[model samples]
Target: MTVQINTDKNVEGHDSMNVYFTEELRTTLARFEDKITRIEVHLRDDNADKSGVEDKRCLIEARPENMQPVAVTNYADTTEKAFHGALDKIKKVLATTFEKQKP
Candidate 1:
């Protein structure tokens, strides 16, 4: 599956982070590799210039091969936390989604 990440101006979005997270995603979502076409990760700072609790936001969208895309969002103090939180949520959602189709 293809994975891409997007970040707003407030987020640093360095190359190292992207590479690490991309690989993590590939590994984490390997089970759905054939059913999913692409995965998009969005990271941003809700507070912009100011620092506050849960200021970091992460949105993860998964596009299934022939179905509507589903997305999940999470917020936390740090970007890593927010991203992982969203990742966890998306995993649950995707699991429940596919499970429903089982006979």
Candidate 2:
């Protein structure tokens, strides 16, 4: 599956960050790779330049073949945490969706 990651201007979109997120997402969604055509991840710092609880936000959208896209968002103190949280949510959603479609 193709994975695309976008970050707000306030967040640095470096190679290392991209690689890290890509690897994490790929590993997390490996089981549904066949059913997913692409995954889009958006990262943002809601309290940019300031400190706050759950300031990091991650929004993930998964496009499954022959199905409507599914999206999930999560917030945490760190970007990684938010990403993982969102991933977990999407995984569950996709699992439930696929299960319901089974004959």
Candidate 3:
């Protein structure tokens, strides 16, 4: 699956960052490889410089052929946490979506 990541205002665009993000996504959702056409991840810092509870926001969108895109968002103290949180939500959404499509 193709993966794209975007950071809002706070973070700079970098090849290293993209590679890391894509690698993490591939590792996390290896099982859905063939079914997913594309995955987009958006990360934003609620407070550019502040550090506190759940300030980072992560949104993940998964698009599968012939199906509506599945999307989820979560907030946490770090990108990893927010990502996993969103992942969990998307997993549930996809499960329900697939069930509805099954005969």
Candidate lDDT scores, in order, read 0.94, 0.93, 0.84
Model 3, range 14-87, lDDT digits (tens) per residue? Answer: 88878877888888778778788999999988988888799889999999887788899999998778878987
Candidate 3, run of 10 with poorest lDDT: 9-18
> Could you give candidate 2's per-residue lDDT for residues 1-103 as a string of tens digits?
9999999987788999899889988888898889999999999999999999999999999999998999999999999899999989999998899899899
lDDT of candidate 1 over 1-103, digit per residue (tens): 8899999999999999999989989888889888899999999999999989999999999998778999999999999999999999999999998998789
Each model's TM-score, in the order given?
Answer: 0.97, 0.95, 0.82
- Give the TM-score comparing model 1 with the true structure, all chains together: 0.97
Tell me the TM-score of model 2: 0.95
Name the candidate, 1 or 3, with the larger lDDT value.
Answer: 1
Q: If the candidates were sorted by their TM-score against the true structure, best first, what order would they fall in?
A: 1, 2, 3
Lowest summed lDDT across 10 adjacent residues in model 1 is found at 93-102
